[model samples]
Target chain A: MSGITRDTLMAFVDGHLDPTGRTEVEAFLAANPEVAAEVALLQRQNDAIRTLYAPAGAEPIPVRLSVDRIAHSGRRRNNRFLTQAAAAVVLVGVGLAGGWLLRGNADTPGIADRLIADAVSAHTVYVLEKRHAVEVGGDEEEHLSSWLSNRLQTNLAMPDLTASGLTFLGGRLLPAPDVPGGKAAQLMYEDANGERLTLYITPRPGIDAPRTELASLGADTALFWSDDMLTCTITAPYSADKLEAIASAVFAQLNPSGDGYEI
Target chain B: MADILHEIEDAVPALRRYARALTRDVDRADDLVQDCLERAISRRRLFRPTGQVRPWLFTILVNLYRNSLRGQRRSGDTIDLSSIPEPAVPPAQPGHLALAELARAIDTLPPEQKEALLLVTLEGLAYKEAADILAIPLGTLMSRLGRARATLKTLTGAPAEPHLRTVK
Candidate 1:
């Protein structure tokens, strides 16, 4: 009775103690009326909590909460055929809109549209590549940066994503017909799990657009931000909030001269 | 593969119960559970053969919950308690007062304590499993559980005063 610790009593009440330990607590409680009452109270509280919420488990789970159903439906929705069909529709729509919008401007595509297109294209191209995804591997990051900057005609810095658990995977140069130089820089990063994310950078398109536009295309979310000199698009399968965190880090590194923007 | 999915599906009910108790809202709880399941399914390849899926899923759920909390903190959105649909139960029964008091006390507990306590008491997880889920040492988990129960006893007007005298 004297040696009964509070933890032993608690484990006894919660049914966590082994039989020998529980018997010791039981003997202690038999001699101590107050300890018995406290144990009883704890039991009642546990019972009350179970009574209040355990019915939720007993209730029929809604169809939407079904994991198999959700996974199956999501897989169906993300199927290559359906995705390609959807992408075709989106591309045709974007092409039509881009044509109309370009007809009005005669010189520049909307920066948001261009960035989204560039992101999806980059994601599709490199996600499929096994051996040569990036022009320069992340191991040659210094050369990757200077090369990308020279190609894009802008001062580009490779944002370190180690804090986000994503390591640099290298970068490449792409055609950005919407930009002044008709070129863009794509920096790729892969997490420890090999989930790849890419950042598409182009010289600023000279359009006064919103500082941030978060858009979802298929399974990927694109977070687009424009500073005075460059517009960067971060495309990943993560949620906007996750992308926001990564984008904030990317922005801090990529735009050393500009005031930090909320990613 | 399918067996793992089936096992995960079986745990969904308990996951929902735990999440509902944690969030106090059905929709939010389901969203948390869904996110947990999706992450678990997608990452099953990374799961070790020796690793049990339940604890791994719980870990994912806890992390997702923390992340959501961080987002909510940044957004500064206030929850309108009135918007939460009340169950069809009538006025307080003999035990309702104690349950309500315990609920408020739980809301007041730090997130770490609440997470640890719920994994043990509410979900009935083993001490080791709860510790693993919370990524804490076994002793730390026990201490948190002890503290949580003691605080609940005091807050729910349990017989702690007399018990403290006897124990000391």
Candidate 2:
């Protein structure tokens, strides 16, 4: 008989031995009851460990741990960090713009800045309102879409952000002192975590403005994008990439004529 | 890249099981798995297409688990094992190891031994794979497993090693 060392016995118990080696170990065990008993004891120890912890593998995984979700969020976070770095550079420019504001340009804060500030302020006020968060609830989808479209005069579609995990809470009308129509649509959304997002959209500012702008206000981020017809500033406490993702979805539905805003 | 994501997804359940055994807490285990997934997903470029995703993921998880323990130690946080929920299985029959007792005994094992034992026993990983994941030599892995089983036997009050019976 071959010398079946302690490691061999363990290999046997762990089922790591080859077929020939397994047969040899079985024969050895038959000849030696003491070693067989020891093997049985180790086997039971393994079985006990499996019984204690193996069920966790069989349980349903939570949504937050979904691989697709993790992968999506990871990619988004990288983009957001880059955007934040870019936003920092933009902040330096805002500092220059601030210099302009200090020099008697205060009353005429740029339309983009005015719109972002208003979006953030509206978001802060209404997100805390439990009973009256929106003038129209999301349940009235068709009416809400048409009413906001007619009010904004830009064929606005209630962007369905459900795909991005944001629920459309509803829409309301607010005054836009800087836009031609003097009317803006404030649409609110809530995510599964109860955090609120508001989109303040107005007719095109009728003045030359950068096609896109991003601002960080305390814990919130406001992103503004404009085409020839409408301008939208989305304000939320989410990171830039998350807002960017939602913005893409929002633009797809709101425009529907072409691909959503690029970059 | 897409292929790697699918491979990583397939390994999540086993990663979760090992993490659960290591942490003995569902929330903490899931949190560990999440962190592992995020790291693996982000650093996927480093993964070789020819390599197996399971062991790569297990290696990441084991390293993360060790790092977390280090952080906990530095922060002076002690895990209150009693606060963790007990195993859901029924009590063991007579002569079987009392599973709860065995679990506590397993918890008493040094992290290296616990990791090696579970990777082999519960995870049913190949000895070579477990050794690689633990970053230990095969011989060292065997000795750790031996020491772990011996300690568990004594802790759970199992019988002493049997002596050979002489043939007539």
Candidate 3:
């Protein structure tokens, strides 16, 4: 407190000073700003470390690190071990009555999961383009709509969402290997800020999974919905509520009959 | 308790960032985090004295990192220094050397000094808690921090405050 040493200067830099000590150091720095500049440099080094790595905190946590999932899996493992031990006891006592029932097959990959993954992968791939973003530009809306509709084997109309701040850029036909028809259409839209969103539409005639399911992948949020004729997935970097509102506008114009468009 | 698990979950991102900055390899940093999480979950029942999970989690992560370094030192596995890309320094910065140059300077610090510097500067840990995490005395922590700052100054070639001194 009384004597200013190298340690005191560092303590000041690290914010280790008590209030009175801080005042003392402040006075010292005010007089000897050469040393103050040194302190500032150390502080800048701290800023550099944070600048380099702090974004990792904002980046979405990978699915493996999900807290709820990890805890649930841990409990499931414990329950499985208990079940096996009970089966062992059953073999010792009840003579293998239901040992075969524990052998269920591995679950099949859900169709909605595949659709969302494909939609996001496709969105991630083509959204970065400056000139080649879409197969048909928005300048030729009638022809682009007909071409995509003809290719997708469904009646496809471009959803105009200018009121929602997203302008139609264009559409591109993409390979949707997960769907029965094996084809999908991507309609690109960009807001005034140049943030892009894509609507992935495929002919999912019979695939029904609650009509709407939302999933988060990295920085993108995907909302997938299906009607009796076509399945539409809207993927964007916007919030879930924003995307939902946009999707509502999209679905209303997408299906003329408008059966399942409100939700 | 589920609350404790939630707290540890909340700390995961910061832990990952700190680990990434320390190791500078994505896979290695994530593997370290996974191991740290698993150990904390298993041994948490033993350290629930005050329910202070943040420092405890940091303690486990720091120890695991040190042990890994010790093992790597014995094994003689080479880290290709050229592989770590330097961050781009935007030209509009006001008064500093290139930020990438500062990054490489930080990389050159001794392991102990680097740990002290990061825990204080990067992680914003209190000096006492940081010392506790490192299992070093408070004075030792200060010395390590002092040495780290000195080395960074030398490597960064920080410009002198000619104007301020002239005013003085």
Candidate 4:
């Protein structure tokens, strides 16, 4: 560090020198004329270069540089890789906070994604329970609906999926760590051959996400949609078409009077 | 998530300034900046949570510019320097160099040298940050800057004497 070299001088001229180093270089320049002139020449060059280009930094930035718009484009591109089947029905929900973190925004692993993952994890864990699959079995329909509705703080009426060739097995209250409510209601259903599906419902009070998207997570196909009051993730090992059909029915019974699930 | 976008937004103007100097053409410069923004935003998860965004963005822009140059050359595209009329400038005063001649001299430097020089001088980046963006060692960046300045001094017809003669 004691040696005075050309790089050191250049660093001094460019303000890259630290204080102690600057003093040493200053003393070195005082004892040297040619080296001092070279440093002055370098400083002049820097000034000329700034004069030629710094104005561009002050120019008004183009609208095309909008960060949100660019992030959206990335999400749109990200969606192309989502191999699952259902249409991305816009479910623009209550507030834009959690919902705004949806779709192609998956790469950053947002809160909504964590919710969907938690749904899938819960589904995988409980669907295998033999004697105690649900805390309050589906046998007590009125009790299950009332208890889960109270727990999730949402007006959740079990969808009458009996018309969809499935029986309402039961429902349970689960922890939804990523959502605002901190609780989710999971309803279990099974076809005649015992094919199981779980609907993970959480009251997204401020989640302005009004989107219906189908994503294939491992062996399960998850159809995620949210309206102003509630957000639901339907995860099943069924084909995409089968999930879409069940999702339509669930959406219908979930919100019969309000915003019809848009495709 | 919006925080990352905010950081990227803060870097846009500086990125455009660097691109403009590098390309010496407005449309091309803006095009480069646009490409840089799209790539940065689309893959922002790669951004470190506590890290600064300005150097990361410059790294992306420099890589894209290099790749574009490679693609253009593969197809035999060439830049016609003569058509880029040097901007009008007043005569050089005693110690001053002609600004237009200096600009042309800059245009004539090899891309690597020009990039190193401008990053330090024009963009005012610290040497380490400039080197990191260029993906080169600090010594290599210093050498490039040294050579670029010498070339500019010669091409601008600035007198070459009295340059670092005191030390052997």
After superposing candidate 3 on the true structure, give the runs of residues whose Cα lies further than 4 Å from its correct spot.
A74-263, B49-51, B88-94, B159-168
The RMSD (Cα, Å) of candidate 4 is 15.2
Best candidate (score: DockQ) = 4
Model 2 lDDT, full chain set: 0.79
Task: Between candidates 2 and 3, name the one with more favorable DockQ.
Answer: 2
lDDT tens digits, residues A84-174, model 1?
3236435655334334444445445456665666666666668668799898999998898888888877778889989999988898888
All candidates: CA RMSD (Å)? 11.1, 16.4, 21.4, 15.2
* Per-residue C-alpha lDDT of model 4 across residues A105-177, encoded as one tens digit per residue: 6465644555665676677778888777788877898999998889888788998788878888898888776
Docking class of 4: acceptable
Model 1 / residue B118 / CA error / Å: 1.6
Top-scoring candidate (lDDT): 2
TM-score of chain B of each: 0.84, 0.91, 0.87, 0.89
Off-target runs (Cα >4 Å) in candidate 2 are A74-263, B93-95, B162-168
**Candidate 4 residue-wise lDDT, B59-117, digit = tens:** 88998889878998899997777777564334354257667678888988989998899
Candidate 2's DockQ is: 0.23
DockQ versus reference, model 1: 0.25
Candidate fnat values, all:
0.38, 0.55, 0.32, 0.55
By DockQ, rank the candidates, best first: 4, 1, 2, 3
lDDT of 3 by residue, B5-108 (tens): 88999899988988887888778888788777765654343234253688788877887888899989899975677788766446235346566777678778
Candidate 1: residue B33 Cα off by (Å): 1.2
The sequence of per-residue lDDT tens digits that candidate 3 reaches over residues A124-224 is: 76888889999889999999999988988888889999999998999999887777778999999999999999999999746555465666554677777
